[model samples]
Target: MSSSFPFPIKPVPFMYLGDNDRNLPDLSDDEFCDLVAVLKALARSSYPRLEAVPLALNAYNCNQGTDDDGERPWAYFYPITMIPPARLDEKNDLLPNYPEIELDFEVCQDLKRRWRSIRYGGDDNNNNQSMEFSPPARYRFLCFIHKHRIDRKNTLQKGVHTISIWDREWDELIWHDTYHVDRISRRKDIREFWRHVKAPGFIDEVDSREHFMSRIRYRTVYHICEQIEETLRGPVPPRHTIYAVMSTALFHMNNARDLQVSIVPDRLELFGGQHKGLLPRFFAHLLCLCLDVRPGWSRARQKRFVLQFRILERLQWMRLRTREYLELHDSDRDGEYRVDAKKKDGGGRQWMYEALNIP
Candidate 1:
């Protein structure tokens, strides 16, 4: 060991260098020194004012363990060890993936104001309705299945049950000719029924948040029915049947049980008083990076990969090497640094040492 370097040079762990159980070849003394030389160069370039230790490049220090300076020694010595090059490309979802949607200026402003009010440290107990605006007609329609507790898949598909529920709830609609029908013909019958009938006046009025939400649902169901009729080359579907299908689509889109009916139109350009139209796309990119494919890698490996990315992204690119190199000499050594070659906890795990055959 030299006086300039604080820690003594240590050998690579058997799992990474030995050719025994895992069929990995052992590194010769000369090869080990060469690897240390490369790491030394990296550390020196990273921290021009700080000295580096040969022991920092050892297998035990190869993971996220920090030196006395409270800095990760290996991170500065070999940046790629933290995150492989293949995974770096997906770290950013740039401006291209998300495009701005055009919207009414007044509605867009309203949406923007609402999104802004709840950004940082707001009361969680606050009513969501106050923070959220009344959704458009189309978005409102999705809520119908929820409010009425309709069985979209079964009850709505079978028009008889759906109409019975609607007739019971509204009473004024006066649904007739329902003595022994199990299913109403989806095409001609629905269209003919709508031709002579209309929803009650209260259905269209938005006196309260409930009314507002209901109105949206009704409008959206009507839109879906119209689309079905035009595309199916027949008649509009009864609101009940279409509600079932809409609910199913909503479930798939949200991919959750909470069933979020509120839709933030993409056209809104500001949020929390900041330009936010493309903010979601940026987060989407980050999510992709964190959830990148690791094929057979364990959860621990995936977590370390994400942690390295978060740390690296925040630091200055030019000083990266310096910060890592200084940790080698700036930190104190407690004992002979060693790595448990067979540890399965995933912490301080090396990539080359991974079981490649794991399925």
Candidate 2:
């Protein structure tokens, strides 16, 4: 169906989820200000619902604390719209009565060209069935807070002060506080709450920003591990190769040093799927070796592995080493070689190291 709104109804320029360079398209200060103004004005009258389009931005407070310290600002977008999917009949054909079908901005260009070809019978592509049944594209206006820039005074500026549309899919995973959802239900004005931090009703909800960073970092690590798994499917990678892959991936991320020292036991719990928490299959088996635990042990038994050695191996994986681990050194016993067991198992095998408390 056609929109009742007048001419300027078009999707804004957008960025796909997981884009590294998430800055808004370069625009002059005046243009940027005007865009925000128009969006706000439109929300006030033309689209009242847009005023409630809540957005949670992970704000990194660079001046006060480490990169991991951040606040989730209760922000909202003033201008955002979605065009609904086409009405399809029982046979999966567009309804004859509905003539005007608005194409989604995300898939419009490619779909338009392909639809043209199909209508004219100009192409006989075998992939048409897949394309026809593909899920509808749903785009939404989203924003990313720019990394703080150092001002002339050498202090980090409050970045992303104004909203400029950098679009994303509606279902994209965002940094949000679920608490606000309940607050909004109670009719709390979140925008005002964040704005007036010193207000009597204001609550201190700011939390360690590492969780958000961890999400991103974990995705990066998982994908890297996935690629490594796919490439070296059969043979177990040597310790050095395994170490190289893990170290390089961690080194590139924020708080690399700290992360390498230990991946919280809870974080290990996060890794799971068809491999049954033993993602990449081989990596899990090798993890036992790194921590001096038995290989091919079930996940329950694996959970009891020593945290310290795993962290050391994980750290080694994140860094570049010119030399192999020294077999004679005392530290080598911590990772490169197994430590002498203080006791023996019921089966008469030497017991592995005792599980250390997670820091």
Candidate 3:
């Protein structure tokens, strides 16, 4: 289905006060409270039907200790619930579909010295209290965009047009590039870098390297075409999947002597980072492409299509094996009198010529 939400999702800004040396903005308690209030008001204005606007604050310690003292809640925001509009006559108002916003607070004791140095001689609270307010190491704000399945049949669309939050001074907050979740290309690059660095010995063993290279020769081309087809149709595949397919395609294309595909490391580097089940997903995409099938196709249709191609490919390989066996037997008997037919047919025996035509 086509996306109901607009392409290129905009980034939402979150205040950060991590590095004192860099002169980052300090989000004071009053300022933070003002920001939260503004965000809540904005959400209500845009989506009036919201029943309860829940916001969560999580704290992370850079230097984690074994003690549970670090896990205590450093700060809290009052719970805000909106009154549900009462229905009049027979008409009912539509409910708000806004996603919950979560703010993460990275608390580092190491940065406290730097923070104190930046705000030297600041007023300190001497009130009688058992606990003291720990200085914030860093602040990150996160807002989620709910994945909505747009139905062309429905006349009314749900969700906000712009994903944004305003600061107290009425200035529109802007997100840094680091906070952009929709940066698929950037994410891919990070993934690839981690993968290569972590798996330096992935192709070290001779037998494994040979096996991987041999399988990729037939599998890579088919996978690339499959990915292209998916991309052409609506609902683009996941970034990770696309990266894996493209990476395999490039690797095989570079190694394959007959194929005219070229290498672009800049592009391939996107698929190389830390991710769950990355290796399996990589191999799975390769296998699916090799079989010329996709996830959404009917099981029966996929079986028929893939099995037919597999049978044909195996038969062709078997034919080459039989021809080789016959030639070997003939050579054994001829004893230096055999014709140069095997040498002449070497060009025609190339497996890619037949395999490439399957998909």
Q: What is the TM-score ranking, best to worst?
A: 3, 1, 2
Lowest summed lDDT window (length 10), candidate 3: 161-170
Model 1 CA deviation exceeding 4 Å by range: 1-122, 126-222, 236-359
Candidate 3 per-residue C-alpha lDDT over 1-359 given as tens digits, one digit per residue, 9 for 90 to 100: 01342321111122443432212233445443443342232222222122122221111111112232222111112132111222224442333322232232221121121121111232322222322443321212111111211222222442211111111111112111111123343233222222222211122211253343332211111233234446675332232232333233323222222112223122213233112222222222222222221234554454444332222333343324333332332232222212233565433323322332221
2 versus 3: better lDDT goes to: 3
Candidate 2 colliding pairs: 247-317, 247-318
Give one digit per residue, the lDDT tens place, for model 2 in 244-300: 222222221222223122232222222211122221222222222232222345544
What's the distance in Å from true for residue 328, model 3? Answer: 53
Number of colliding residue pairs in each model: 10, 2, 5
- Tell me each candidate's RMSD, in Å, in order: 26.8, 25.2, 26.2
- Local distance difference test, each candidate: 0.25, 0.24, 0.25
Clashes (candidate 1): 10
- Per-model TM-score on C-alpha atoms: 0.18, 0.16, 0.19
Best candidate according to TM-score: 3
